[model samples]
Target: MLLPQPRESIQDNQKGKVFFVALFTVCFFIMHYGIFVFVQTSMFFAVSSIYRGDLFNLSIPALK
Candidate 1:
């Protein structure tokens, strides 16, 4: 018969799982939000430049 594992070890394993899940969720949200913001900003700049008749001069604000 297989012996049961200790309770402390089981609890620690569960805690580790929870920590990794929380960390993954936070990282995913940050990456998604960052990508969204980047796309939106780029599109806004592109449109604005086109509207102002300077499409060729379109550049990131930070590069100015």
Candidate 2:
């Protein structure tokens, strides 16, 4: 029936969105961790702040 086709298409769209979201989330976390590990804390915080819209960049290099 036409009703079933629409329902299936809707489900497919939802699944596609969910998959992309999860993939992006995983990539985001991985990239963040990699940056923190490879770069200085101050630089990392500044970049992270930009992405997070934080009030200010907390550059604490000594913490490293």
The C-alpha stretches of model 1 lying farther than 4 A from their native spots are 1-10, 50-64
lDDT (Cα, tens digit) per residue for candidate 2, span 1-64: 4343344455765888767988999999999998877567556666755344343653444554
Every candidate's CA RMSD: 8.5, 11.2
Per-residue lDDT of 5-47 in model 1, one digit per residue for the tens? 5666677558788679889999999999999998887688767
Q: Name the top lDDT candidate.
A: 1
Q: Rate the local accuracy (lDDT) of all candidates.
A: 0.73, 0.65
Tell how far residue 53 is off in model 1, in angstroms. 12
The estimated TM-scores of all candidates read 0.60, 0.43
Query: Against the correct fold, how does model 2 do in TM-score?
Result: 0.43
